[model samples]
Target: MEENKNKVVELLKQYMSTPENEPSRGISYLKEAVFILNGQGKTLAAHEILEKELRKFHDNSTVEMAILLNMMIKLSALVGDFAGAVEYSRRAQAICEAKNERELLTKVIINTSGLYFKMKDYDKALMHANKALQMAKRNGDEINAACCLNNIAIIHENGETGESGIPYLEEAVKIKEKHGMNAELPSSYVNLAELYYESERKAEAAELLEKARTIAKANENEYAIVEAMKYEARFLKGEGDLASAINLLEEVREYHQENGNKTELLGVLNDISSVYELMGDSKEALNTFKQITELSRSIFKEEQARSIAQLESSFEAREKLREINDLAEQNKRLRTVNEEISEKNNELQEMKAKLEEINRLLEKQAETDPLTGLLNHRKMKSVLDSEISRAERYETPLTMIMLDLDDFKSINDCYGHLKGDELLAAIGKLIRSSIRKNDFAFRYGGEEFLILLPSADMQRTTEVYSRLKESLREHLEIAVSFSAGAKQWKGESSDEFISIVDKLLYEAKAKGKDRLETSEAAI
Candidate 1:
């Protein structure tokens, strides 16, 4: 590796001294820079070598200079150095525009749009994406047009509704299909599926998701597979399947974690912890959050280390240059300078290690029924939305049960509100223990509580409700029996299911409480 690096450096230096138009010499050097010391892992080292070579040559209108600039643009973006990417892109764009090279300009513009997208400047991203799409379409370039269409959709996705992005995704998918761009199709399909999801078209979204998964697997595209998994996890999250979603996300999390891709790892961890919190699993959430805080701090420490390393490296380089110049004047001073620099380097290493240990303790507490430690009303509502989507996709039988303490005001009057509150808390605990892991038990404000059981029939749900009531009666010191009403899901929205069960609960109370009533599907 050291020999090859020295050889490339010598070749670049030889080429740099030659004239700009020296018959493929400049292009050859750029190609050597790309292929030999290509900046995959050691980007900074590659960038420094390439930059030194680049600075040696004067600016020119030759195709070679253009190729060098474009390569630099891509390499800069590859290393997350967007500022360098923009500057290199601007230089390339100037050459392309000056030469009236529409095709090259279109490609550069598309790349610029992508850079802006990474920068999160949606308006500028949209502007460039639109320009590139138009040029690609005008010139009959299906590949870039398809890519631009996808970019436009992504930029539009920043909108709240995501409705406006639908057309662009559809068009992009259509173009990809037309050209048989299988490598690119998965991303378009995934994007379109998400927009369809926003529009509440579950079957369409499901079909697209399946297509994306199949193609991604066949192509063995790791990035495409990971991206597909991210959307699938998100869909599952929306479907009220938190455990499954978390499992899927953990795969993605592990992939990024093992690869040392800290940015993506941070994103996946945030999603995992947020879902944990929403599922009323506070301990899991806090654990995930703790991981996030540690990773974030580690990233910060590396960045700080790089900054300090650069300053020290600069100082050392200048000191060595000075020592070489002053060799004739004094040789003894060089040893002292080296000793002082070594001590400073040691201090910097200590500081870097200290920075790594500094972490933000960002602990998240789950919102629960404080007394019973069960899910509160808000979290339950989130669960309902997620579960309803899940039920729709799997055609699963879901049952919603609403239970009210019988004549709770009268009970409060008889035993005092304190005893009533204790009974409610006890009932919450009982419900929490009785339900399945997938089931959600929520305190629905005041004396009423709700339970959602997915993939369960009406009879089984009623039995579970009866068992819970029996358990409560057996365990409590005072005699206690509550009224409950359950309604099975039959292609109804979450609000409809909730309302039907609520009405049935009211019927049980009117019929003299201490009974369970289930609403028939026909009603």
Candidate 2:
């Protein structure tokens, strides 16, 4: 490593002096130097090196688009420049999209989605992660899929949305193990350990952290090694080993200092301060806090200087231009303002566009039943109308299932609306969990949700309906039961198709409320 570093520096010095080496040797030397700096934990210096290289070779073919963008991603992430990271990821994504590089696209999406996560925008994170997951599966890129799953798990965990993330993390771990990705296992273990910790499984967390530490040390992964040490220090602190924790934190700080990881070193300083405070070493704690304050003040002053320079530049630009011209120019400006006012008046007369948009979205949402969060009658009709046309045009099988909660009104009357709503939501969750990619559920009417399964034959539809029924029976403890009436697509209008299932649904409700019924033939 020392030899490689010396050779890289020599190449950089050589390339800097010669114009001919600018494209090849210069870029190569810069890349190698950047890697070496990163290994030495000089992240900011490494970032500066890459930035200069990028500027020098703005359109050089020697530097691949993917490589440049990836460097940007890493540097921006290290500097906490999330917006810049997102922008670079977008550029990478556009290139990937143009080339149909699905795997690379997935990776870019994951990186972009991480920006949303850092900003505490879970919905957007989930959206991008899910999209990446779909694309990864389509491209059969298991590594990308695993990465997507892990990211989704992180979002879910942070959002505290039950245990939805557990399965995703578990699947990612399984994939990593199967693929012999030993280097990635430490991160997976750390994430899994966090999950176990949140789930109140301290023993499991401890065991996983131990495994993580072992692998990290064996691999000489400094970042993961610091994380493991931090985790162990935390564990010791929790166990009331204050002195031991302090010793570990100090040792870790020394390790990071040797590794040139200033950020981690500062973090360890903070940890040591906390431990000292807990141990009644007020002088040591105060000194540590003072150091942190000094660093913070230095950063703030740098930012203030930057802001002042930007303000001066803006002032110069303003001074270079005329604010207002002669009387004729002022008159012309007044006329233009009058014209804009007239346009605004005309727009106001047309409609309250923002209010109208909000109303339209609300109306669409209202067509969803509140309890089950499925489409109500109006929306279901709209969907059925579209699906009917699609089925006929493509000559593909489209199945409809009209599911009614049996004795639902009685249950609502007996258990009251709260438990009734719970039952409905639980069933809705079940349907959402059970459906295929092409299938959807909509609350057709009171206590009735309609399921639309495109490209499903009679047998497949029947099997799905059966599984749904069984799932509800096994999962729901409430007195509510569901009866479903199913039908395959025929050359019929939307209303006629729905009537067929409705008739069968009534038949099931009349005979018994917990059974399935289907049309023998299409209309």
Candidate 3:
């Protein structure tokens, strides 16, 4: 214990001493000191140092401010002070916005998006992501754009339609390629590949993911390299190579911890839990799951508690807004009751109209996919459900086809992640091209894609799938293949129907890995 204490002290001194050599090192040292102290079970001491250091600088330096803000948010979130983390993140975002700091603004937005995501506020998360993406585009920041795309894609993957998210990510890849920014390519490629896989385009997904791994190794971004390894593990799992997948995840976990990336370390632990689950080691899986739950709780509980104070402050602000709105309404009502105030009443009416218009815009924003400017998952599903009803009522045909990629991982591995992303974007374009005016395609999850064809029978569905498969192969000019499962719904529950098709997709993978399977009700 004495030896451990001495080592930690020495590390802190060494970290702090860097400022003497490089003046810009102070903030890094302060941030790392807190992280180190926290890891050493000195939570209170870490908090004290962080608070003191943050106060000393007032967060003026760009690098220091970003670091400080991230640390503050992380520590706050860890303690279950979500509201405080959000507030600090908002403050950081405001500062970036006020100063017209495009790069900083993107970083702050990413953090804000992350916080909202954890809260399951997908609407707010996408809002911030859209803001960041807009900033990236305006500034021509490809890396930032790619990061935003991946995050937005994750949202779509979770919401309902991963297909809707693909276009945004594809665009992001194009931007990365245009700029030759290779560092961020791996994760982006992996994301696109996952979408393809989920779409039952296993072959395309595998090809793209392989490309990501190769690129990571070539760039020697150790962190990204390890991440690619993790992705590879996931791909292997889908390929039924469970043992290899488990081994890869374990290796990644060890490497991440060795490198002291504790945040990633936590992810590795969670991933290990998943691998155990996959292996059917129920006991190990449960224990690992418990560990992750505890870790997450430990990280967020305090932050959530701290955020309560911030939440109260926000509630007060909201209440003030409500009061103002009420007064406006009352004044309008009084004006309507009287007649001499014609022009004033007219102006008030215009203001009210404007507010209504604003509300309408907000509603549209909530239901739409901000990245691709398309209908979001919830909206799409509602439309699809209605369409299904319409088709059934009329006795017309309705078919949904699941699309996925083939051997996409190899692209990420070979040409680099950026190139791999370029490929995905190109592929997304091809998929979109294959759709007719009446057809719709959505990102189902990860690399899995979905296409809905209304008033189409099984024969028509098969014809469209064949054409689409050929179109993608020719246009993408890659060994691209989609393992699709198509079904024409009968009198079965939509969930059951979708599951039947989804299972058929798995069967397709089992048969030859890059073929399509169609199943209809036995009737």
Best by TM-score: 2
Q: Rank the candidates by TM-score, best first.
A: 2, 3, 1
Residue clash pairs of candidate 1: 239-386, 240-386
RMSD of each: 12.3, 13.0, 16.8
Q: What tens-digit string does per-residue lDDT give for candidate 2 at 192-274? A: 87666644457999999989898878866666776777767866765679988987787787776665344446567788887
Sort order, lDDT high to low: 1, 2, 3
lDDT score of residue 333 within candidate 2 = 72
Candidate lDDT values, in order: 0.75, 0.73, 0.69
Backbone clash pairs for candidate 2 read 375-443
Report the error of model 2 at residue 251, Å.
5.0
lDDT of 1 by residue, 325-360 (tens): 778367667767877999999999998777654432
After the best TM-score superposition of candidate 3, give how far the Cα of residue 327 lies from its true spot, in angstroms: 34
Candidate 2's TM-score: 0.53
Best by lDDT: 1
TM-scores of the candidates in the order shown: 0.50, 0.53, 0.52
Off by over 4 Å in 2: 1-4, 7-29, 60-63, 250-523
What is the clash count of model 1? 2
